[model samples]
Target chain A: MELTLHVWRQKNGQDSGKMVTYKARDVAPESSFLEMLDQVNEDLIKQNDEPIAFDHDCREGICGSCSMMINGKAHGGRKGTTTCQLHMRSFKDGEQIYIEPWRAKAFPVVKDLVVDRGAFDRIISSGGFVSVNTGGVPDANAILISKQSADTAMDAAECIGCGACVAACKNASSMLFVAAKVSQFANLPQGQPERMQRVSNMVEQMDKEGFGNCTNYFECEAACPKQISVGFIANMNRDYLKASLLHQEPVGKA
Target chain B: MSWIVRLQKSSLGSKYIMAITGAGLFVFLIGHIAGNLLLYFGQEAMNAYALSLHHLPYGLLWVARGGLLVFALAHVFIAYRLSFHNRAARPQRYQYEATLQASFASRTMPYTGTLVLLFILFHLAQFTFHLVAYNGPYTDSLGRDDVYTMVVNAFQNPVYSVLYIISMLVIGFHLSHGLSSMWQSLGLNHQKYNLLFRKLSPLAGWVLCLAAASIPLAVLVGVIK
Candidate 1:
């Protein structure tokens, strides 16, 4: 199948980007979306032109590295599927595909189809962890956890930090991402010690990062490649409220 | 920064304000609708209810009104602030954005909320302040402010009835998203009950809208005369 692509191109973060058109000729229908882009890049290299730059690692979809707005949708409009997993057959012959980087103030364009998602890492660094000291590994069964709680925690833990939630949200909110991190810990027994502090610090970091607030639009759930639920956000909100109301110590101080 | 300042400055904190204030207002709406439904019980019953409210001890009526005013102001103020934050968060928008999960009510929250606010002001002016004249006399047999007569006379006018019904519908739309979203914002959500809230939120909105609209329609059609 042949396809016309309008891909956003930029020299660097400082460069003003614009949509540059390219044609993917004689592409196989079975080729993944990233593979199709690779084919296009190979052709560009032969002609001595700069290839389109995009982020992709572990094309199997777990890394959450491949981020792009294909046809104005995060991850090519496929629910629970990343760009690297999207196949060319999703489009028809001669179809025009518009590709752009994630359009959030937090995620700036790095180059063609690539945006710097370092903000996500910074948000995570703020408090997305358990501060438990490294001692002898405790018996897994020593701290008995209910199956339901464990499953809920695992569900929140599935978030890949892709920033697609921010890309898809009208407000560019990272509430879902932060919520997932907060919920993963909040739901577990081991995560209880600093639960309040964790929520407050992470939320403060998310705010400082210039992400928008969640208005319960549920777009993040729809656009999430990992199919993360917005319920985690509610959990995060609950934790933050408790922490804000009851805990007097500043986030980092505690 | 102080916690209060952080709460005020953070986007999520403002949403918490909206949720809390919206919940307070929701409670007021239920009470208001119940009182208005007294119109179905005839003029004496409605007037007695109004008199009872006015006669509450310790200046309770003023206190309740004052509380509602604060809730209204907080809800609207936080919402306005969040909207500005939302716009600034996304300076560049998608060329062809498509929504997959957000409802029509969810997308048009600001417009519906503003409409509801205007409707509330108009309602208060017409009924509470008597700034707008009713088509007929408002006095009851006991020389009290005949709440039922005022409502019936106002609805008897085609223009007022239609406007009332339309405004109620807009309020319904606002409540459809607002009620359940308040739950999520306040972290009252649970996996077991989240679906229930989502389904019931809109149902509650429809119930309020229809119940409120029914009074005007009934009055307009001479069912309550």
Candidate 2:
């Protein structure tokens, strides 16, 4: 199969980018989208030109490092699939695919098709952890978590921290990502110690990171590679509301 | 930060304000529509209802009016601020954009909301304040402010009726997305009931729009005099 690609090319963080077109001839249908891009970059390298820069690691869709918008839909518009897992077969023989980096105030473009997602890390660092000092790993059966609670927590834990939700959101909100992280911990017995503090701190950091608010558009859910539900967002909202409304300072140094 | 400041400054907190104020306004709409439906009964019934509202015992009318005014202001102010924040969140525009899950009503909320705000102002000017002139007297048989006659006369004008109908439809568009969203924002959503809310949002929107539009349409067609 042959395809036409309109890829954004920027030299650096300070450079303004524009779409540049290229033709990929004799591409195999079984090749993943990143493999196809690799073929294109290989050709560019032969001509002594700078290859297009895009982020990818596992190529198995779990790393969440591969991020790009294909034809304006996040993760190539597939359901529950990441960009690395997207196959060339999803496209027609003579299709024109436009690829660009995730666009958000918090996730700025570092180069062509590569964005700096450090904001996500900062948000997680703010509160997304359990700080309890368990000397050794406790017995798994000691917790006695209910089946329903376990399943729900796992569902929320499936979030890969990819910024596709932010990219696809019309408001560029990171509510889904933040919600998944909060809900994963909020549902477990071990997470109860810092539950209120976790929600309050994460939400404050999310706001400080300059992400927009969720207005229930549901675009983030559709664009999510994990297909994470927006219901977690409501849970996060509930937790945040409770924490803010009924908060008492912990008995410690002020 | 203080909780009050956080509620005003944080995105999630402001959404709570929007949800609470929107719910308050929605309640007012339901009451307003039920009262206005009295117009179909007869002039006496509608006029009596208006008189009762005017003669509420302990200044309750002013209290209700004041509460509604506050709710309307908060809803509009928070919505305006959120929209501007949303626009700034994505400084760059997509070259080719496509929406996969959002409905037409969901996508056009800000536009419809602004139109409905203007309609509200116009509606109050024509009816409540008597700022807009109509070719009729403003008194009924009991020498009260004749709301029934004023409403009918205003609707009799073809231009006014058409504008009112259009504005009602726009209100429907806004409510289609706003009602269910208020539920989600308030944390009332459930996995089992989420689909129900999505379906019901548009149904409620259209029902309210049709009910509001019926009065003007009835007047225009000479069905109500």
Candidate 3:
């Protein structure tokens, strides 16, 4: 199959970028979207031109390293599929695809089809961890977790920290991402020691990162590769409000 | 920072304000529509009801008015503030933008909300302040302010009725997103009622606006006479 690609090209973080069109000749239907881009890059390299740059790791889709907006939909608009999991056969013969990096002030473009997602790391660092030492790994039943809670926690844990939620949100809000991280810990017994602090700190960091607020549009859920539910956002909001109102902590120097 | 200030500065805090104030204003609209529905019962019922309100013993009406004004101002204030912040979050927009699930009403909320606020001001000017179009120190035989006649006079003009209908549609559009989003913002989510919560917005929006708009259409058609 052959395809027409309109790919955003930027030399570096400081360089302004534009969509540069290219032709993909003799492409295989089974090739993943990233593999197809690799072919395009190879052709560019053979011609002594700078190849279109994009991020990818573990083409298996778990690392959350691959990020791009294909035709303006995160991860190529396929449900529960990452860009690396997207196949060329999903497109019609000679189809034109527009690819661009995630658009968010927090996730600025670093190069063609690559935006820095370090803000996500900062948000997680703020309070996404269980600081208390639970001492050695215990017996499976020692924690006394309900099946329902375990499932809920696992569901929230599926979030890959890809900024698709921010990319797809009209406000560029990272609420879904932060909510998932918070929910994953909040639903677990181990996360109880600092539940209020975790939500409060993570949310504060998220807002400080310049992400917008969720208006309950739920576009982020639809664009999510892991199909992470927006219900986690509701949980996070509930927890955050409770923390702001009821959680008492001593005023101390930083 | 103070916890109150922390809450105010947070993104979720602004949403909470929008949701709470929006819910308050929505309830007020329901009462407004229910009261106006008395128009179908003839001038006596409407005038009597209006007169009873005018004679409230301890300025309770002023309190309610004050509360509504505060709700409205905060609602509009947070909406624009969030809108500006939201716009700045994305300095560049996608060239081939396509929304997977955001409804048309949800996308145009700020615009529709602004239009509805303007409509509310115009409506208050005509009906509450008696400052536009109608000439009357109108009173019924019982010597009460003739609110029924004032409302009928205002709606009798085709242009006025048309403007009113259009404004109601815009209000309905705003409510289509706001009403249901209120629950979501308040973190009132459960799997059992999620579908109901989602459906609440459009269903209530259509029903409430249709009922409100019906009064003007009825007046214009002389049905109230």
lDDT per model vs. reference: 0.88, 0.90, 0.91
| Highest-scoring model, DockQ | 3
Cα displacement (Å) at residue A34, model 1: 1.0
Please give, for residues B10-113, the per-residue lDDT of candidate 1 as tens digits. Answer: 77778888988998998899999999899999989999999999999999999999999989998988888888888888888876677768999998898999
Cα DockQ of the candidate 2 complex: 0.80
Model 3 whole-model lDDT (C-alpha atoms): 0.91
Relative to the true structure, candidate 3 reaches a TM of 0.97
Q: Name model 2 segments beyond 4 Å from true.
A: A251-254
* Candidate 3 structure quality by residue, lDDT tens digits, B49-100: 8877777889988988899999999999989999999999999999889989
By TM-score, the better pick of 1 and 2 is 2
Query: In candidate 1 chain A, where is summed lDDT lowest over 10 consecutive residues?
Result: A245-254
User: Which DockQ-derived CAPRI band holds candidate 3?
Assistant: high
Candidate 1: Cα lDDT at B91:
83
Among all candidates shown, the one with the greatest lDDT: 3
